[model samples]
Target: MSSPSANASEVLIVSARNGPIAKLTRDEAEQLFLGRRTTLSDGTPVALIDLPAGPVRDRFYLLLTGKNPIQTRAYWSRQVFTGRAQPPREAPSAEQAGNWIATTPGAIGYLPADHADSRLQALLPLR
Candidate 1:
């Protein structure tokens, strides 16, 4: 059997400085990330990190696009190849991803719930 998944999933919404103070519903996160619409009221692209390929990502996959992370990578790669938009930065782990997003401007990434720190905001509670 596959290994247990990460600690938790937290969807954080970031702003210029002080945000993701606002929490997000699972559905809202679904639209933002998988939609890749980049035209939300805040007008920033949603960012997702390299989550382990397992049940946690699976649940998110179903919630978002009904596709796996690999599929999402392919979709973003195609977009990048065509110069339409850029894919979200890929981090090795949740902490690394959080560090990147927390420092970068106009960035939003999902991190495992317990891992959420002052650097990153927690959006949704673990179920």
Candidate 2:
């Protein structure tokens, strides 16, 4: 039988090959996505890319930030209206997100595990 963690769905946080980031803890990822952190561990400026609203997007935010979709939208709206931060760039699908992360310097995005590949470096796994 599989363990709970083994069975749990996971979203892979990925970056471009040769990007300054190596890996991120879940808390660090949360901070980045929440606009609380803007750079990678090596002090490289990074951009956040998000998958369009759907199961993978939902699961990634819920598991990493403990925020549901509605709450997340509200949070970003407040930040944007206050001129504090902009929401992440969004890709229309997992494939697009993966491709963006793979080719863009300092770009980071989450994808369902099966879409992860050598083109991108997996930084964190959020369940």
Candidate 3:
């Protein structure tokens, strides 16, 4: 699964020695990956992020939520106005997203599965 950013890279998760990262079930991952507010197995909050709206974001949204980006945004907005947690932060690009996850403590985001590069701590197998 080599990609542009990670031509010869291995993504190894770097997490706390005493505990696990917030791995999620597929269903849960779908929810978070699609910009729905989701929690990890340990009940930690998961923030789903994507580049502002584009082809890849559209595809990811559809794959994860079975809906288009516009619909996802509408749904996310409703969740926010209703006092639920905010939708995932919108990073401008893969570079911005990587930077955000790299620096933001207790936060997590994803990139191309192959290019994840262990930049952010990888969650365990979702159970």
Candidate 4:
């Protein structure tokens, strides 16, 4: 029953427990999520995962990029049409996104605070 305007203050950007990334600034996270950057400042390639098109996904994009779901869709459409980049792989839900991030090396994704657990290393708090 989430909505695009759901309170996202509890969202967290996360990675695998052993991921090379220890932390990320909001600018770096925004760049990575928007497909503007592929590697961390230290050059570790990032495998970004995203939640499927939904309230959580929309809320994340809105908070991270200040773009609504429709705007984000258009942005990605252009990126794809221009061959600039593909959007991150989509997970079925926040819990699944967290699971993937925890098990995949160099993987990063955002999840609701409750879903983030010991398997994942939280890099940044969206709020």
* Best-fitting candidate, scored by lDDT: 4
Go through the candidates in order and give the C-alpha RMSD of each one to the true structure.
6.1, 3.4, 5.6, 4.6
Arrange candidates, best TM-score first: 4, 2, 3, 1
lDDT of 2 by residue, 8-93 (tens): 37777888877777777777788889887788666878889999988888888888889999998898889889888878899988
lDDT string, candidate 4, 70-118, tens digits:
8999999998788888789999877788778888888989887667778
lDDT for residue 59 in candidate 1, whole number 0-100? 59
lDDT of 3 by residue, 1-127 (tens): 2333442223322222223344545576665554455666677755455556676566556655677878877877787888775677888886687676666654555555454544455542211
Query: Per-residue lDDT tens digits of candidate 1, residues 1-127?
Result: 0114325453233322364324455665655565445544565444545455565555555555677667876876787787776555557766676677677665666554555666565555433
TM-score of each: 0.58, 0.88, 0.65, 0.88
Off by over 4 Å in 3: 1-22, 33-38, 113-115, 121-127
**Number of backbone-clashing residue pairs for each candidate, in the order shown:** 1, 0, 0, 0
Best by TM-score: 4
Q: What is the lDDT of residue 66 in candidate 3?
A: 79
Candidate 2: stretches off by over 4 Å: 1-8
CA lDDT scores, all candidates in order: 0.54, 0.80, 0.56, 0.81
Q: In model 1, which regions exceed 4 Å deviation?
A: 1-17, 20-32, 44-59, 125-127
